[model samples]
Target: MRTNSFTLLRQMVESGMGIGIVFGRFLQVRRESIAFVELRDLPFASPPVACCRMAGRTPTVSSEAFAAAIKTIFHNYGG
Candidate 1:
């Protein structure tokens, strides 16, 4: 089973349906019903993300800033 919802994933894990593999950040503030195990040594790559806009459209200043912020975050991640 696959879902985009973290809440549903947590609920399934808490209900003992199965285990979930998510980023450790999501486990920072969590309920006690489930025990989280961080797989730091696992060789998994994060999926690519994009900041997309319609073709030939001019980006707003806020959008440009947001893209820059995202780029900075990606560069600094896991460092």
Candidate 2:
């Protein structure tokens, strides 16, 4: 059934068999795939990135240091 398929897919994502297909802006990179296409175009679906929230208080750090750290990590990964 369709519900069963959805449950299995959710499990796959949670178990790291694959990454969840997300849309809007949360994903670091978005791939063009069937799941992406379907989810993005679904009339009943909410904006994927909008579902998340700030988990805790913001870190106390200068913006420049945060930017530098992000840049370093991305550069190291060749991303």
Q: Candidate 1: lDDT of 33?
A: 66
> Model 1, 1-79: lDDT tens per residue?
8878878877786675655555434533633565544333223366333221233445578756865675566567745
- Candidate 2 lDDT tens digits, 1-79: 1333544644564453433433354342533221322223233435542212112324345634754564475456553
User: Model 1, poorest ten-residue lDDT window?
Assistant: 47-56
Highest-scoring model, TM-score: 1
Candidate 2 lDDT for residue 25: 44
For candidate 2, which ten residues in a row score worst on lDDT?
32-41
lDDT (0-100) at residue 50 of candidate 2? 26
